[model samples]
Target: MALAQRRPPGLKAVVNVAGGLISAIAWRRAWMRSSRPSRHWPWKDTLPQLWVYAGNDDLFPPSLVDGMRAAALDRGGDVRLIALPDVSPRGHAILQNGRARFVWLREMDTSLRA
Candidate 1:
């Protein structure tokens, strides 16, 4: 997702597995709805994006990702975020557990097909 946003030319598709630019900074915990990141989705002119993140992901919690989603949507970026149930005690592992493959893969296929 981040890569496609950064390099938005002639890309086939994007699978953002708990990845983004705003998550790079973690010193503060603020709602991103009005944050600069919320308005910084550069993919509005590009293809749709698939974002897969674990619910218990401490690195990119739902609170933060939700705001990002809202922001991207507001900016007209085609992004679908699949907030999966807690897959592992690790909190940041997306595919670490075998059970989550079906759900994530399904979403991925749909988003990729778009």
Candidate 2:
């Protein structure tokens, strides 16, 4: 599956909006400094999972994904990285094209039969 890439303009606007929202909600009591919250791991350590990341994602920089891969490797977990060359985050739209959709379906069919 192709990674969902956010356009540059869309990415910038989303970041700005998120920052503004965070600032506006900063005064809420739920985020007060006195709150002691328990931390929990959502996934079991034994589960086999694949982490798919894009190298040219505008929302998430390549360095962040590289760091995640390094951390996962350190923990002895299997990490599969899929990097597309000369592609922007907006390239995800290609998946929506009829030809691309047909190719994706064919790949899925082959995988399932195997």
Candidate 3:
């Protein structure tokens, strides 16, 4: 008679599962503010921000990101809204590969140094 044995998933599988769960929770928390109409965050002008959005991003469309960038600028904040060309629709996936990723890293380095 032959018997079948089952083994637990490896360390990488465990980490990936844990990371996905954590990411989902974090995304939910961050997006919760979108449902409230009366809530407004008082942004400081001292803090600089780099808003990276894609034209094909269904989540945060170009128009919405533009408005956000305009709002930040109106508040005298240092903000750069980089609209990538022909990028992934995932939006966040823009940083996963290509020249845009390197550009983002360079910008971050410069921002941190200044």
Candidate 4:
């Protein structure tokens, strides 16, 4: 509600507020429904064991990844964050373009084998 007031008047703002409200309501409903089940989400009881592979130029800020890492640590979960320097969100594509697809394939193969 506060967010809706801050936006300038336009179709985009109206759409955004409407979308946000709808999404919020839907998410609340889903969360309530899911919680009623006997089964628990693993992450709730035990911290998620997260393997975060993020690029510097991801659409989301790096702080988001850092926040996840912090939250995992707070919950006593193992968090492995691999940072690829000089990499963008499209870094893999760049690697492929540079004919480093074989390297990527090898890494994937090793990971799968492990």
Ranking by lDDT: 1, 3, 4, 2
Output the TM-score of candidate 1.
Answer: 0.77
Better of 1 and 4 by TM-score: 1
Local accuracy of candidate 2 as per-residue lDDT tens digits, 3-70:
11223332211111001112222322322332321111111122233333333444434554454345
Candidate 2: regions farther than 4 A off: 1-46, 86-114
What CA RMSD would you report for each candidate? Answer: 3.1, 13.0, 13.9, 15.3
- Candidate 3: stretches off by over 4 Å: 1-44
Measured by lDDT, the strongest candidate is: 1
* TM-score of candidate 2 against the unseen true structure: 0.38
Better of 1 and 3 by lDDT: 1
Task: Return whichever of 1 and 2 wins on TM-score.
Answer: 1
If the candidates were sorted by their TM-score against the true structure, best first, what order would they fall in?
A: 1, 3, 2, 4
TM-scores of the models, in the order given: 0.77, 0.38, 0.53, 0.36
Cand. 4 TM to true fold: 0.36
User: Each candidate's lDDT (Cα)?
Assistant: 0.71, 0.33, 0.45, 0.35
lDDT for each residue of candidate 4 in 22-114, tens digit (9 for 90 to 100): 233333444346733212212321312223232543432344445444543554444444444434335333343333344444544554454
Worst 10 residues of 3 by lDDT: 11-20
- Cα displacement (angstroms), candidate 4, residue 86, comes to 2.6
